[model samples]
Target: MTTTRAHGEAARDDGRSAGRPSGRMLASYAAGSVGTGAFSTLPGLVLAYYLTDSIGVAAAVATVLVLVPKVIDVLAYPLIGALSDRASHRTGYRTG
Candidate 1:
């Protein structure tokens, strides 16, 4: 007799339950999200405050200074990733 497995049966062969992350994994993910949130938000807030209150920059100018880099980052990171991928392909990094 022969049998065929369905969608998630392969996962059980490795002792994992399909479609469900573990409690510890969930907690870790939550912590990572909190850390990522702080890192992404605090710098902008701190920079704007520093530029306006400490350095006496106008609010509008401070806003622009804080935001322009973020805009550049949003556009540049994907382009950089594409370039890195192309370079890696040319270099044959993992084609052994």
Candidate 2:
């Protein structure tokens, strides 16, 4: 049996062209993930420790402050996608 490379896809050792990742795609994903993680996780970790040890704020209040922002992410993602869809842009690119 034999396989062949398809257009745009990279040819692999098996002779079939497997999908290749675009550098922009990877970079965008990496940047977004880092930003989101920093926004959501870093504050929670830092504030929780600060409130529990240094500030003397109640644990419950500290937990709520750290958590509510993260919970809002559930709605924020779809809202952002909806906004993006409605937005008019000069540049267009393939999603997949």
Candidate 3:
């Protein structure tokens, strides 16, 4: 089968123009994933380890410290998503 892309271009399910990302784009995406993963994971691991092991804080206290921000995020995300959706609806484009 075929699909019509923008500008009246015909797209097909064949491997040639099936919208698969180029190798360079895939490599860039992989690098981005690794960087993003390290940035997101390392801080939490280091912070928890530092708080408990180096600073001699209690485990429960360290857990709470880490969790409190996530609790706020859990609550805030829905509100933020709703606000962005509303803003987009009103303006016909995303606010940011």
The candidate scoring highest on lDDT is 3
Q: How would you encode candidate 3's per-residue C-alpha lDDT over 2-86 as one tens digit per residue?
A: 8889899987754554445667777998999999879976898789999999999999999999888878888998999999888
Winner by lDDT between candidate 2 and candidate 1: 1
- In terms of TM-score, which candidate is strongest? 3
Q: What is the lDDT of candidate 1?
A: 0.82
lDDT of 2 at 3: 38
Compute the lDDT for candidate 3: 0.83
Candidate 3 versus the native: TM-score?
0.59
Ranking by lDDT: 3, 1, 2
TM-score of 1: 0.54
List residue ranges in candidate 2 displaced over 4 A: 1-24, 88-96
What TM-score does each of the candidates earn?
0.54, 0.54, 0.59
Better of 2 and 3 by lDDT: 3
Estimate the Cα RMSD of every predicted model relative to the unseen true structure: 7.2, 6.2, 6.0
Counting clashing residue pairs in each candidate, in order, gives: 0, 0, 0
The count of residue-pair clashes in candidate 1 stands at 0
Tens-digit lDDT track of model 1 for 1-96: 333477534333444556566788789989999999899989999989999999999999999998998899999989998998899878886332
Clashes of 2: 0
